[model samples]
Target: MHSKIELIDMSKKNPGEPGIEIIESPEALAGQINKAEVFFLKNRKVVLGIGGAILVAIVGFAGYRFYIDGQEGTAQNALASVVYDFEADSLQKALNGAGGNEGLLSIADNYKGTDASNLASFYAGVALLKQGKYDDAISRLQSFSSSDLLIHARAQSLIGDAYLEKNQPAEAISYYQKAADYEKNEYFTPVYLMKLALAQEKANQPADAVASYKRVVDEFPLSSEVVNAKKYMGLLEGQVGK
Candidate 1:
């Protein structure tokens, strides 16, 4: 059984032919307009909320950038005397302080996230190493960061030297390898390779030591380390032959 459908005759006679009006009444049109207005008002609130969040993020980033710039300036000024002390071979004064000025330790602590602070970490680590504070040196050196490849490489090598002084040949070899591979250059590569070879030898890895030395001799022929690398490689190979 199907349901019946009804059709209403809305046509009215105005002349010979009838006409039909399908337009909404004024009251019905006003209702639709009101509904549209209400929808846009709700959406406007949501748009405003997202805009406010973006504004807050922008303001927060601006404040942080300002703070970092200020810290950079302050740290650079504070490190001046510390660098002088370090160059002058006053390792204690470089690490701590001399006279009324602050040293690398204080500067690094005060401006913890600045480039100058990272340099302070490096200076303080080297000062500690010179003072025979191997663990402290390692800690300070590891805290330092730099965008400059040469500086980063040197710092890694310095850490290896600290480990060597502590008689930890395995750790020394690890850092030496890191330094060698950190920034491959004619100057630093041969230097770190020599140190890596020496560390391998100290660790009783004669074969590995020989390989590292040969790399320096073959790849960095013009380097000062080449002479020493050739000498050590020959000595180790002879021992291996026996």
Candidate 2:
């Protein structure tokens, strides 16, 4: 599943120290300035040392940001090159590049802190899942983190899908529930709720499955999933009653 790439803004300025003392007159202001000068003269060596360290820190931070920004661009380009393979269903080539292009795995491994690296994890996981490598898919998906609600919820749902493929319905239920509950909305929540219900049914929790399905029908009546949810809910409710 493709998602919008979101770049994290790390730029921030240090806030100035609070609580300024007011000077009632020019004399008082001059006196404060003189006292500051005298104090600086007394602590000249220490002040210079602290100032030098702060300057070094600022320069180092700026340089690191520049380096990471460049790395992020490179990683993004590499990722874009491989994503075509992914979209074309060339799962192997997508995961492990071909013909001089770096693959999703290489981008993820080579550029650790870049946003593209994080997105590579998601792409790699989906490719692994398509390849039927459930365990590896789970690991790759777990490594991904996103602040976007839709993407994060989709990742959780994909994890649930991997677990379900492995026949671990209980684990699938947990992740599906997480996906269903995360930033609940009409567009995605009902879909996740249906998955949660199916996983619950597979786990032999008839009552819980019924509840999950009923949520889709009642809470998301306008959703496309509601018809199927209602059908499943009726079936499970009858079983629960029996």
Candidate 3:
């Protein structure tokens, strides 16, 4: 009986804050110099302290990047088969290992802080979820992050699903809301809102459920989820009306 169990971009071209803030020209350089003269005259110590901190940060970041690149290369090698195993639905092999190859869990731990390790954490969580290891799934999923909005939201949403399966509707509702809030887009926003509404309903929060469903209906009118969102909103609103 499948009732309402429905579940869940940064553009590379635009470099965002880093690109915009970077000093790129002589005219911009003159503006910065004038501002710096004013600022440095008033707060020389503060300025020096900030400059020192930034230098240290730059050095530390460079070192960390060098370290992680090597680690990620090795981890990627170890992870080549594990990712395929996971995608191929060979769940146990994805977690445990196969044919003398390391698994997602091992790559995550052995290559901590690398990009590959972060992906391993996500894959490991997903594998654990499929195997019904709900607690472990939540733990692993919570540790993973990505610059990609969809992946991050999906990881949080997967944690919600794990908690729901564990009969923890309150926790599920929390993560579902987090997922919905993590990325507000036409694609994933309504989908997560529907999940959030279901979790709210499960937790007996009719008002919240109604509000979430109404958000999907109003904000994402053309979404595939909006029809179900309207249906659920009406059901909850009727309950409140009664």
**Index of the highest-lDDT prediction:** 2
How do the residues 117-188 of candidate 3 rate in per-residue lDDT, one tens digit apiece? 999999999999999999999999999989799999999899999999998999999999988998699999
Best of the two (1, 3) by TM-score: 1
Cα lDDT tens digits, model 1, 128-198, are 99999999999999999887999999999999999999999999999999999986999889999999999
TM-score per model over all chains: 0.77, 0.78, 0.73
lDDT of each: 0.86, 0.90, 0.87
**Clash number for candidate 1:** 0
Q: What is the lDDT of candidate 3?
A: 0.87
Clashes of 3: 0
Candidate 3, pairs of clashing residues: none
* Whole-model lDDT, model 2: 0.90
lDDT score of residue 112 within candidate 2: 93
What TM-score should be assigned to candidate 1? 0.77
Model 1 lDDT vs. the true structure?
0.86
Report per-prediction Cα RMSD to one decimal.
12.7, 12.4, 17.4
